[model samples]
Target: MIEVKHLHKTFRIPAPHLSRWERIKAAVTGDGAEKTAVRDISFTVGPGEFVGYIGPNGAGKSTTIKMLTGILHPTSGEVRIDGMSPHKDRRRVVSRLGVVFGQRSQLWWDLPVRDSFDILCAMYRIDRQRQQRTLAELDGLLGLGEFADTPVRKLSLGQRMRADLAAALLHEPDILFLDEPTIGLDVIAKRNIRGLLSKVNRELGKTVLLTTHDMDDIEQLCDRVMVINHGSLAYDGTIGELRERIGLPTILRVSFEAAVSLDNATEPELGFTVAEANGCELTVHFNRQELPALEVLRRLERYGTAQDVHMEEPDFEEIIHKVY
Candidate 1:
């Protein structure tokens, strides 16, 4: 289990390019401002749970992950992984944790994929016998064997990601922390990674915390989601609950040979908004949380005969924007 209580992290940014005299004055007056990358946020993740931590860029997602992995210290509050403080008991906490950052690599760039795994085994002190067994299992699950002999720099992005994932699990860490692991991957690559993650979470019973801008990852693999905005916890709940809470907007675009009046459709509480009105086409947007699409379509009939009607659901990015 992972538990965080009132977590906070602050950084003091210095005023740069100041004159010496001005510097002295600024120091005395505390002119340098402090920015809190992570505010007083708190949440917990039980064993074997897959949770998605999402936010726009610079929203403290990485800050929280770093603190949890003991890569950085929290300015105040507490961080506990499986009931042990990450900062206080760094080695022990780290031994049980596996972290994957999409923009960063923990592997040696010049080394073969298998060679990197050997280095990791040495660092974690896993015996060769167990290492081989783990490799066999990972190869089966992630198909790492196909590119295991290639140098990290020579492998494709998807291949490198698979290698990195195997490297993290070579020692079989209990909890996995992934930050944008599927970034820049193609649709097929993303699906493969997502399927592997689901197996890791469900079959192996590993606690997984994934952070990504891709909402499909959350929609497919995550059972619960936590959204952070402006260094604070903006939301924490199941994905279904989040959709219901926000009432995602859906659009109905009607094409007509002639213009039709919208006054005939009167559902004041349905929160309808006119998105576009042209000479022969009309567009109406309504919240799915307020009413069903079928009902919305039926009401639109009152306007007039439409040559063609098209329904559009907002994209994943739009749903997340609503959360923010």
Candidate 2:
């Protein structure tokens, strides 16, 4: 479990120097300028919960994660992981946590994949039997056997991601933090990662906190989601709740068997906004809050027997856009 309250983090950045005079002026100005990356943000993740933390670029999502993982210190407020302070007891806290940054690798680039695992075993001081069991389980779940002897630098993006994921779990951490775990991965590779994460959460009972820009990742993997915008908590709840908050409308596209025009008639009382219509094809937007989808269908029958109907909800990108 993780709890963060009124957490704040700020970074002092040097101002750009326009001339030698400006450089000298900044040295005396003391740090030039400061940017508050995260400001008074607060949230909690329950044990065994899979939560997605999402935001646009520069939204402070990474800053918050770094603070939680003890990679960066917070300026103020409290962060507790399973009742332990990560800042004060970083080693003990990290032992109970797993972290994977998509843009960074934990594996040794020049070493064989298996050797990297071995080094991790030594670092964590895991016993031989436990290490073997963990590696075997990871190999089965992540399919790392195919390139176990290959050097990390020689592996593909997908393979490297799987290897990184395996390395993160070698210690059997209670909580996992994944930052863009599926970035730059092909469809199959992304599927593999998602399947592995689902298994880890369901069978292994690991609590997970995932930060990603991909809506598919969040839709497929997260049960609960937290949206951050402008360095603040914009939304937090179930995925369905988020959809409703954004007023995301479901689209129903209908192609009629024959062309017909009811343009002069009173608009059908479907509790939906008409998005588009062309002779036989009509697109309607129905707010789930105002009407259940099935009811919308019954109302559409009055126009004509629909040749086909396609229903779609908003994707993660659209939802984030609405939040921002």
Candidate 1 to truth, TM: 0.84
Candidate 2 residue-wise lDDT at 235: 90
Residues 1-324 of candidate 1 have per-residue lDDT tens digits of 999999999986557888888878877776777989999999999999999999999999999999999989999999899899988899898899998989889999999988999999999999989999999999999998788889999988888888889888888999999999999999999999999999999888889999999999998999999999999999999977786777766788888766777664455754577778787788888877777777866666666777888887767667789888
Model 1 lDDT-worst window of ten = 262-271
List candidate 2 stretches off by more than 4 Å: 18-30, 264-270
| Every model: Cα RMSD to truth | 3.8, 2.2
Q: lDDT of candidate 1 vs native?
A: 0.88
Model 2 alpha-carbon miss at residue 322, Å: 1.0
Best by TM-score: 2
| lDDT of every model, 2 decimals | 0.88, 0.90
lDDT of 1 at 188: 94
Model 2 clash tally? 0
